[model samples]
Target: MNPLPTACKDEVVLTLPTILLPGLGIPASAWNNVKAHVPNAYATDRLDSHSPLSLEGQVNRVIEFMDDRDIDQAQLVAHSMASFIGEAACRLHPERFTRLILVDGSYEERRKACLRIPIEKLIPHATLRAIVQEWRCYSFWANELREIQRSHPLRTRTVVIAAYACRPGRWVRKLRRQAQQLSALFVPMKGSHRLMLDRPEAIAALIREDPPQAQRHDGYAL
Candidate 1:
């Protein structure tokens, strides 16, 4: 395992994780391929069992973590629901972010709309089962994993990779509601959902191409 640099005292660059999933999944480890290209990158440590059930809570946690880590500014790359949090942070404090790469970002409005319907509501339950199921075959994650891939079909290489790391279950409805509020605030990524792991190469190239710029104090929502 590559240890995070200990003495980032002069300047520390942080990489925050996506919501409702661990770093081992989706964007966290997947981003390792492009780490060498980044100047300074440290994955946000797991927040206190406080999974991002809502965008605000997630963003707040991230902000607090940055304060704790003394990360004054950063280039954010968020996948899935976590993308919304990153956007919120940037909007809340423009000077905090150098640049943002929202991959496969599921906006608050869309996610709530998805949960409002009868079938998509299963996502919460599915997420729950996936997390607690002892037998992998019995896990709710398998079905949800299959559904996400089916709903947002991507290249086979990406599909295979995502399926391998899925840990599906139900996210808290309260959290889902928080995510919905974000719909009014930010624009959704191209794929509508699941963009990062699904299109790692593309997103990585985008991040690599856009060199970090000094952040301006003017707060703007994106």
Candidate 2:
């Protein structure tokens, strides 16, 4: 018997994750917690190493996935590094997305810090699962925790804005240095490392606040 197709393109509520992180340390089945609430949510599987590590690759994969499933656009809710990819997609192909809801994290900070860290000297296996364990274990007591807290979406947008603005060109430079990058600035929220897992309800509520395509049919976009 032919196996069932993995990607689902139906026009239901959609939410995607950051590609860098591996499943947020949560079980795939745990995603049902959010999916149960949304109408039809599809989660993209982890990317193969052969795929480009640049943010554009992530965006292309999503676009391709949707295309394969006959989906034109979707409502994206990205977590962590995935937020960067979502932002890139929005800027490059705004029409392809209806609404965007970035979870409690950002890639602008992560990519820079990770690049500086001597990963090969630190840990050869730089997989998402390994990173999660490293975080939980307090492996790098450098400045990850502080940065993570600062990137919380719960933190007043004003505060986050000020934090980034005060940093001068360092943050922006890191983002700009990346050639094929997502061009959206992510909003930080209040929560620990696991933003979505720690605050799914809050995220879901925020998503619900976004007016769907059906509601915008009145010729007055929200």
Candidate 3:
């Protein structure tokens, strides 16, 4: 682990170790820019492509990574589909997470469905094959989402950063509604879904900012 710079008394404080999880089919390199600005943070490799297909398996991978590094607790930053994995991990082990930061994430429940064609067999490229395998795990994703919905109002502090640029109004509204449902702090960001890639500095700032005291919103616990 890297050491923090020396500081005068009351000048500097430690921040929670941060774990960055990328979206489905997106490489961990997508978080390189954001990682550059964060200290004591680690970005997970592309688990959506090569890791286990089941959500429980993916969550286990994260736990194992933390355990290997002796990280007892961390702040999770998840983007897109990885939000499902992060939420599930936190739900299963809430004591291990200090905060959950979800970027451009959706909590809409999904139902399992079979793909008519076997794209993996048809596609020769390795990258395409990986994507096909990820798609094949739709049932896992659906089951995880269902479990998260059933276990709402996560014990860990939660924040939802919704991207508004170039996105449909309804989609943005849906994200806002989901944030409300989770009783999470809602932050509206000006960018596309790939905020970590396009606005890494801003995202890092949000990560480093002190979490606000929990408050009630529309009678919902936050």
Candidate 4:
């Protein structure tokens, strides 16, 4: 793969390594297509699938993974639930991440602490085992979402890509407003929630594109 170009005038040839984080329950192989396009990219395996960990623990694991590989800083590309982990990790340790790309990320209101639903019971038996194994992950995700709601806006350069199918909806609008507040570039792409899997080449192309203009509030056209 060719080295990714920067948007700077000096045309720096150094390409920052990329970290691809999959959503909850998604296998590392899900990022295979995108990984194939970026030779320097590393796709992380599911962090809490087997032995469950708290959200903070997952963030620590991500940092440790990078540190173990001697990666000082890299572009973080996260999808769905992993977006929460990426955002939190970046906020906690801003120096470890150069940029953040949230692909069809989930943005919801802070979860109620007292409201505990039997998620495993609600799902079918076939998926019950997986849910049982991932119950802690689910809990951590909800708690993390609440924390993110009360957290400060991100200072790192950020890009948010929402699915076109979810356009003209309240969720997308909310995400747009959040992006504006963070001065992040928001892009609406033609795909489903699983946009990366649906259009890996397109996703990879966007990842390879130059970073968004710093402190820009306007959204980008496809």
Candidate 5:
């Protein structure tokens, strides 16, 4: 099926821009090589972890970013925490998205679903920042997790790509099966979770596999 378009009419973000997000301790530059392969992709920075958000806040941030770029509908590609961010966004607004290309998305799913500790309230703001500077992780913010869990599937075309060599053979198989159960097109690639840094062309090629219709294409008016 053809991919959807962004809400904007002018300043088209064509070539099926692959909106990319990085996991913890990673930076937007991780997708630089990947973006070099995929001309229209957009990857955000994770280095400035000075500010972080809850799941809802993260999703809203993505929506707002898309709004700024006039990207109404685009494929979501992310790793680790950022992968969850895109997933939460798709779950919240399924109609606004198309395909999801998740990398290491199901990383420690069972382990990461713990209760959120009110670290901010327990400790001083400066102390909290020093202790855990990064924003909301999977385990915290139980309410948002509940909402995502309770959410009905929007029937989005999902794809889950895993690291080919990260886990044991049995565990990897289990993860692949889990991806399938989640209704995602499972693909185990040859690398670690941070494969984007080493193999951008490979990642870009995968994204290009299902190109979305661009807003600036001829005869396809907004």
Candidate 6:
């Protein structure tokens, strides 16, 4: 791994290795701008290699990447649907997480709304299930995950970079609220959901900024 340069802005010293995860169907180049600014951060499109159809499989792949890098502990920066995979990893093995950055992680509500329509009427149940791995899968829709999140300390911060006319505003608000309750400092950015593509410099600048860390006395949240 290349050494990360000292971030220009005055902030807490960063020593943890940073692992960046891409969104579903997103290429590693998507993180180019952000990674360019964060010298120490590593980017991978490993998930894109297989074009895996399920989010849980994406989560497992992240673990494998961590193992390959000997990353017992590192910060996770997840954008778009990648938040689902990153969140799952953090939940399953909080010991490996020093922090998590949720970039554009509020698209779940829109997903749910889209999945609400009865596609089963148009397609066979098995076909619909195979096609829509996100909605019907227990990996995403599990109430247990929600229950765990309700009281658990996230032990991290949130950076939300939203694009113009981003639908499902309510879900974003909910995420913001949850971040606050966890005592995390949230930094909000505006541009497009494709912030990495449209405003890579700005996204990189934000990634370079330090978000507020939560105070915790217990072990990992998991």
Ranking by lDDT: 3, 4, 5, 6, 2, 1
lDDT of 4 at 174: 77
| Model 5 lDDT, residue 184, Cα | 73
Best by TM-score: 3
Ten contiguous residues minimizing lDDT sum, candidate 5: 213-222
Off by over 4 Å in 4: 1-12, 47-51, 114-142, 145-153, 166-168, 210-222
What stretches of model 1 exceed 4 Å from their correct place? Answer: 1-27, 45-48, 108-202, 210-222
| Candidate 5 residue runs with Cα over 4 Å from true position | 1-14, 111-136, 141-143, 166-170, 210-222
lDDT of 1 by residue, 152-213 (tens): 32211110011112332232233233334333212222332444445444445455443321
Better of 2 and 6 by TM-score: 6
Candidate that beats the other on TM-score, 1 or 5, i.e. the better one: 5
CA RMSD of each candidate after superposition: 14.0, 11.8, 4.6, 5.2, 8.5, 8.1
Measured against the true structure, the TM-scores of the candidates, in listed sequence, are 0.44, 0.50, 0.83, 0.76, 0.74, 0.64
- lDDT, candidate 4, 42-80, per-residue tens: 898863324334677778888987888888888899988
lDDT of 6 at 212: 25
lDDT tens readout by residue for model 2, 1-222 = 111233345644334321122233333344445554454466665423243444555568778867776666566665544455555565556666666655433433232333324344554554654444333322222233333334432211110110122233554344333311323332323345454455555445444443353233123232
Name every residue pair that clashes in candidate 2: 18-82, 88-182, 152-188, 152-189, 153-188, 153-189, 153-190, 154-189, 154-190
Q: What is the Cα-based TM-score of model 5?
A: 0.74
Least well predicted 10-residue stretch by lDDT in candidate 4:
213-222
lDDT of 6 by residue, 134-191 (tens): 4443334334345456655455554444344434366556766755654654444445
Error of 6 at 28 (Å): 1.6
How much is the lDDT of residue 145 in candidate 2? 33
Against the reference, the lDDT scores of all candidates come to 0.40, 0.43, 0.76, 0.72, 0.66, 0.58
Model 3 misplaced stretches (Cα beyond 4 Å): 1-10, 47-50, 116-120, 151-153, 166-168, 210-222
> Sorted by TM-score, highest first, which candidate order results?
3, 4, 5, 6, 2, 1
Cα lDDT of model 1 overall?
A: 0.40
The residue pairs in collision within model 3 are: none
Q: If both were scored by lDDT, which would come out higher, candidate 2 or candidate 6?
A: 6
Cα displacement (Å) at residue 187, model 4: 0.6
